[model samples]
Target: MGVEVLTVSSKGQIVLPVKMRRTIGITDGDKLAAFASDDGVIMLKVVKVPTVQDFKVRLDEAKDWAESVGYKEEDISDIIKSVRLAKRENSN
Candidate 1:
């Protein structure tokens, strides 16, 4: 577990300390999400989904719409699988 105490500054910036950031490999420009549990346990989660960049998301939706309109585009699942594998390697 992390340290049990933290300070929220007057300017509303909550600085995460060095050791916690080191454990997560977080750096500038990464996005984060904050949520609270039913029992009032507020949490900050590193967003892994956003780490998977939005490669061809709009194209995927367009493909689905095209198929619905009886205009089929060729399946590119294999290409996506390869790209996802490469991205996983790169993120690591």
Candidate 2:
């Protein structure tokens, strides 16, 4: 909760304070996302990477929605091709 100092090892690893870890519910082996802000501040957040099954379920739902909207498989394929071509032209 208060200001705490930590030392980085030669391997560039720092142990978070026990109190801070406990308060934030951070456990050992948890994944953390680290990014630098525009102001040069580095921040870390606990994040989860979705599994393959998760993506499969999402794709199924999207397909169901598209079918409900009366879009056929060929229609979807053509739309995808058109969008890809447009994106390529814009990049050029």
Candidate 3:
């Protein structure tokens, strides 16, 4: 768990710190959910964590995990790379 302090702008917008946004992969045009806790604390959560250009990273991570769990490296790498390249093309 981590916390970041951000000053709300005059336009009533608070930019989540870059570190937080990048960590959560939230991007422009994405919707967030805001709620109030029982203790009167305002909470903001990403309603949908966007998959922007992050599929590559996820694929690499998954490959490592799967290999550790006894997956065949050749097959996993081929599939992951294909999907990653497709995502890159689609993002353009």
lDDT of every model, 2 decimals: 0.57, 0.66, 0.63
Candidate 3 least-lDDT 10 residues: 35-44
Off by over 4 Å in 2: 37-41, 49-92
Candidate 2 structure quality by residue, lDDT tens digits, 1-92: 54344688999898888888898788988876554334222334456665556545656786799899998777956876777787777679
Go through the candidates in order and give the clash count of each: 0, 0, 0
On a 0 to 1 TM-score scale, where does candidate 3 land against the true structure?
0.41
Summarize candidate 1's per-residue lDDT along 1-92 as a digit string, tens digits: 33334677999678878787777777888667553334232344456543223324534675688688765434445545676687777679
Model 2: lDDT to the true structure: 0.66
List runs of model 1 lying over 4 Å from the truth.
37-41, 49-92
As a whole number from 0 to 100, the lDDT of residue 31 in candidate 1 is 68
Better of 2 and 3 by lDDT: 2
Error of 1 at 88 (Å): 40
Model 1 gets an lDDT of: 0.57
Which candidate model has the greater TM-score, 2 or 3?
Answer: 2
